[model samples]
Each structure stands twice: as C-alpha cells, then as structure tokens.
Target: MIRYINIKNIFIIYLVALIIMVVLKGDLSDVLARMESIIEQRNEGNWNISLKPFESISSVLDSYNRFGVNIVTVKVAILNIIGFLPMGFLLPLLKKNNTSFIKTMLKCLVFILIIEIIQFIACIGVADVDDVILNLSGCIIGYIFYLIVRPVIKS
Candidate 1:
C-alpha cells in the first residue's frame, strides 16, 4: 500500500513537471518578459493561432521539400505526439477506477486544450490544432500502453 502511494506521488510529480515544461518552456523570468513585451507591443504577428488542422504538418512538409531535410521541423511534430503520452498513461493510473476510452480521451483533450490556450495567451508558441491532434495521438498511444501494462502490474 505504501509502495502504491509512493508510485502515485511520483506520477503526480512527473505530471506537474511535464505541465511546467510544456507550458513554460523557458525560464519563468524570460517567459514573463516576452509576455510583457508582446502585450505592450500588441504584435498581431506574434499571435500565431491556427484553427485548421494539419496546417502545421503541411508547413513542415513544405519546409522539408524546400530544405531537403530539416531535423527541427520533424522533431517538433514527433515531440508533440510523444510529449503527451505520459498524460494519457498517468491520468488513468491516477484515477481510482478504470476509465473508459472515451472518458480517458476527453480528459486528455481537455488537458491539451488548456495547454494550447495557455501557450496562446502567453504568446510563447503557435496555438495549433495540429498540435492538439498530435498530442492526442500521443495520449491515445499512452493509454494503449497503460492497457498493456495494467495486467502485468496487477499480476
């Protein structure tokens, strides 16, 4: 029982850390400074919000075609998916009862949505629908992972 409590605590810590890393991807002071600067300048250009899904993916592919191979562009897409895997895995584990797929998905969607909103409001990154898609993919993958591992852990 104590071991279970420790594991749960660890998961909670990891989730908090993940949120900080995703939402505040820099020094707190630096992020605040940029937020202040953007608010003061009212830089419409800096407010890069994308509602259309795959717009970012299309842009990345276009960059790849033009540049012949850009690791950074590819990395962003992959990271967006992989980064949220922990959320999918951890959230269900944190719940006292088994969560249905739809419920788990809703939880993941809401979590990602909040992060995207925060990023947009802070002017830190592009608030992209593609990111939500990719992040949700990661979460689904993570949920699948949890399903696989649950039996093993129980045994």
Candidate 2:
C-alpha cells in the first residue's frame, strides 16, 4: 500500500529527531553520572557557558590549522548549520498563509534559544552563542532555499 505523509507530520518528526540529536546526544548509560558531575561542578561555581560568538568557529579553525584537520570539529560545525535548515524550510511550508520571512526567522530564533537554555540547565552541552549564530545561519540558508523552490513547488 502506498503511504502519504503530510507536512505537519513531517515537521513533527523532524523536530523530535532534531531534539533527540541535540538534547539527548551521547551515551545514554552515563547520563545520570554526567548530570551528577555537572551538578557538583555547578556547586563549585563552575559553569559551562560561552557567550563569545565565533569563539567556537575560531577554535575549530585553529584546530584545523594546528592539528591538520579534525573531523569531529568539522562535523560539529557543519551539523549545527545543516540541522536547522529543515526548520526554515518546513515552517514556512506549514504556515502557507503567514510565510513572512521575519516572523519565520523570529520563530526559529526562539526555538534555538530554548534549546540552548535546555542545554545550559541540563549540562548536556555547552551553551554557546556560536551555536545560536550557526543555527540561525542555517535557518536563513534554508529560508533562502525555500524561496528558490517555492515557485517550483507551487506550479
């Protein structure tokens, strides 16, 4: 039997997958240990937060220069951008009547911020401004692609 998937369903699936990939990343078995470690560190007044934008990008570039290409760093940088592309594309597609670019970008920004906040609170990942920048860039690039393909899809 042929199956059909609607945009809403696709978007929901994508969002869940994205959350799993970002928030629930790494070995699940050690999550409790990691959380306890983070809590202890926090009790010691040590927080994992990076507010400096491009600090991560610069570190990645520096690593590339010094270590002669690190696949992990490259993968992470690329993933940060590529991951959010669907949000930009699918959100507008879902809201056909209100596909305003500004509004879409604002929504994407809010979503990214919420994810970052979760990361900070849960200590699952470093709450870095660079991630926000890169994710937003990906969203914008996705929106651009949407603009390019919108006409074709409409026909």
RMSD of each: 2.3, 2.8
User: Candidate 2, TM-score vs. the true structure?
Assistant: 0.90
lDDT (tens digit, per residue) of candidate 1 on 72-115: 88988888888888878877777648567789999889988988
Residue range 68-105, candidate 2, lDDT tens digits: 88999999999999999999998888866788999999
TM-score of each: 0.84, 0.90
lDDT assessment of candidate 2:
0.89
User: What lDDT does the true structure give each of the candidates?
Assistant: 0.82, 0.89
State how far residue 134 of model 2 sits from its true place (Å): 0.9
- Name the Cα RMSD for model 1: 2.3
Top of the candidates by TM-score: 2
Candidate 2 weakest ten by summed lDDT: 1-10
Clash count in backbone of candidate 1: 0
